[model samples]
Target chain A: METVDLKSAGFGSNKVIEWGIRTFGKIVTRLLLQADVVALTIPKYVELLRREYGAQNVLLAPHGSFEDNAVMPSFEQGAGPIKIMTFGKFGTYKRVETLIEAFAQLQAPEHKRPALELVIAGTDSPNAAGYLAQMAQRYAHVPNVRYTGYVSESDVPVIFGESSVVVFPYTSTTGSSGVLHQAGDYGKAAVLPNIGDFAEVIREEGYTGEFFQPNDVDSMAQAIARVIDNPANRKAIGMQNYRAARGLPMEEVVDWYMLHFETLLDEYANRKGKIGLAKA
Target chain B: MQIIEEITPEKLTLRLSGRFDAHETPQVRQKFTEHAPKNALIDLSGVTFLDSAALSTLVQAMKNCRERGGELTLANMPQPVRIIFELTRLDKAFNIVNAPDAP
Candidate 1:
């Protein structure tokens, strides 16, 4: 039995590559399902494997970020500007460029608008230099935006603790994101697109966050501005998110997984017993 | 966003077009802060979509206008835009007039 983090979004955009990966994945997944048990983070995929392959071996495990979930320190607003940050690897799918555009359009005189500090932190990948250069050129004139080259795993907690809000502007996805859990763990407010599991995190999980129309920079910025413009609302939302995180303690979630495993094993053994009796 | 502004000491009329969303909201916020008269009117005949962030901005704008002895009103609001207000129950907070005499 093994667990693979299948974060892929369907066949993907490239037809040739998608064809190869899907074919390979299907074959590998079928072979692996022959094993006693397989764990998946996505609920849809768990159901897919169970129904498609008729594999009772598939089981679901909730997404976990392995965070301390201690009381998160409040970010400093200083007397001048509020700090807004987006963490994780910089890639085209993450939509870092669109986030920059949204932040750029938000620039205004300090008094007329809330002063914002945008920290773009994380290692750049897949044309890192080109993307970084484009962002630097476009936001160079704006003094508030800062780019941190690479952030370590140890530093992630500190980074989440220090930001007023987290922005996840991913254009598409097949699976859930750890970033949402990471953000929620710290009780930080997020401004994200209204799609996928994110909507559930906000509406179902009862996290305090705002949703913008998918792929629209203006909608993204508007959500950000709403947070910045109303300090009280943002604070309330953050508090609510923190409370929600406390309610879904990760330790309890892990316990549930263990109990589910016990039940599955019992069911499998019982099924085998019935077959053996029939043969006898 | 094209802002057709009519400003006077008594009132401010801003005819907003295009999407009154995140990217274009700063312009509206700036003008409102600069020329938020006692009687402010936001003509939204051309707005197609309105998100929560923009809704919060409008709420703040209205509060500011009220503080300065002025009122913020929405006129010529499209059905899509009006539905948001009704859903959030902000329709009661702001004066939304569909037509000059539409009852």
Candidate 2:
């Protein structure tokens, strides 16, 4: 079997791999305690695995970030089209149906909608496929609604560069989202639900984004309309977000993980020493 | 952790201080068993912090006091302690007073 060392994977690349490895590793480790595993990416995940299924059973494997050659053109001048994008598995938490209803209301003739397009991207969860199918049928007649079932990570910059704003309609209290971080890094003005760490991240940067009550369709519609109607404000906010995101280099985030790991390892070593002394 | 029990004409007050966490639950539970009072009031004015586990203990205590034919009320909650209650939606479940010393 090919070996991987997650710790040595260059910072940005390591984190992406770690996210996946740690998430899956926990599930697999709990099922098969004696399975030999290689290259665990996340330290917290590894720590949890070790606690449940002895430290010797797992290995850390990290890989460098993939290099994609596709080039993206910079945002053009003038009031660009209001292209709103949301990518995620279709689920109750993502609240995609709420966005669809909101967009449908915007497209109503009475609203006098601006030049706007709503793109729903990402693979729909199997359980939510029926819900997604219902949305597709209901919003079939709505103008400027596009759904891309899935988009590869390499093509993300292309999507963001062509779009003016991104929306995260997630409705949850815990768990972190990589999409929120990705949108920040790409400098796309975002509209997100006010909850959990999202509130902390948005509030800290002073970015030009609005928070609406979770699951409130009318509030979401208003926030979306505000971003689409005002181009100058959108660009200003996007730029501020990009600047703020740049400060949190992936290397620094990984350094935090490394420090945590070192602390855990030292504690384990000291505990083992005490046990040995007692036995002696 | 310390629990100072005082009975007033208006309410039965228990003044709690020090850090409250999961491990301290059993001790608090034992104390409640000994000094179980009707119309109990808990003053968390001196509590530095409270976690979800501690909140569970408070909920259990409230239920115990209510079962004895009286109400359980909380008084003088600090900001951090209040936040735990708010986040867990326990604020709606408890009768919280701003100041325990107030008449």
Candidate 3:
């Protein structure tokens, strides 16, 4: 199956889209089911199916994590060259500058810098090209900082798998984090600034991660050090995170959706049968 | 659209009420220009909601006042209105007063 990573809302965009699609899908499915038609989508979208469309007229198919490979072997020990990944339209809100500064501070003279590779992977936001350009110039002298303009979904798993930690330094009040969830599913630790729904996600999942004061460079730097310095702790936290993320897989999600579709389909079939029987 | 104009030696106080959205911002901007005072004080205590457009207008007005060798100050702003300003980081740009006595 082909996957498209719209990469719209950092960590929360996928779920938000799922919610909107499911809600709208349900209404459409219900109408179609009454007309004896069937509909389908992936499992993560089931809640939208059940909540919006009746449980009867939907077919669900599950998929693996965006980075999951059925053929390739998964890593057992989480400790590796620390890969630090971040992506967003560069803005004051994303706090990419904070992450860059934090990473810079973490690099030490003697300690090999924990094999630190920082990737800021996305295009610039409106009127933010100048700001991002300034950042690029500021950090150009720093080693191991890669600024990828834009990346596709197929590249995500490769990108995510390489990383030991994902960082989200948001400054906004209302928003969700999609990067956080994807990182969690991939069993990578995350470092998020305390903002919006980020704290709730990290706290609820009990992931191996740290929350720091937003816009505070020192606090962010400390959080980065905590992850870079402690690999065993990072792996343990990530492993626990993987377990928490298991229930959110595509198959279970699909099955739930199928149940909803069948119910709606049966209702339509029964109604049509009743009409035929009455005519006879 | 409600405008309560107050004149003082230091500033001109215009207390606004009701929705301060895109539609209202034009009226506010026009009124500000028409009055064209040297110093202006805007009280947003009664405003229920203020969108980004409204905030932009306020910023423009402040800039205009500044150019004229005067200042535009906000006074008696309601909690929700204040929150919007804070959210957009415009609290730093505007001198927001919670109470009449406080600047």
Q: Is candidate 1 or candidate 3 better by lDDT?
A: 1
- Give the per-residue lDDT digits (tens) of candidate 3, residues A1-280: 0122223223335678766665665566566667432433223234344455455333332222443332332434346656678877776466577788877777767656646778888877773556667788977877788887778978877787777777877775332355665776777767778763555444433344777898788898888777767877677656655644442445434433443454456667899999999999
True contacts kept of each: 0.00, 0.00, 0.00
Off by over 4 Å in 2: A1-80, A108-113, A204-208, A275-280, B1-103
Candidate 3: segments with Cα more than 4 A from true spot: A1-64, A67-81, A108-115, A126-131, A173-176, A203-208, A261-280, B1-103
Q: What is the TM-score, restricted to chain A, for candidate 1?
A: 0.80
- Evaluated against the true structure, the overall lDDT of model 1 is 0.68
lDDT of each residue in A147-261, candidate 1, tens digit only: 8878887788767777888888776654566777777777678888787656644543446587788678889989998887777777777776665555445654554355445
Instruction: Report lDDT (Cα) of residue A55, candidate 2.
Output: 56
Report residue A184 deviation for candidate 3 (angstroms): 2.5
Local lDDT at A55 for model 1? 82
Model 3 achieves a DockQ score of 0.01
Which residues of candidate 1, in runs, are more than 4 Å off? Answer: A1-14, A50-55, A72-80, A126-130, A264-280, B1-103
lDDT of 2 by residue, B50-93 (tens): 64346555666766776787777889998988865543335655
**Comparing 2 and 3 by DockQ, which wins?**
2
Give, for candidate 1 chain A, the lowest lDDT window spanning 10 residues: A1-10
- Candidate 3, TM-score vs. the true structure? 0.49
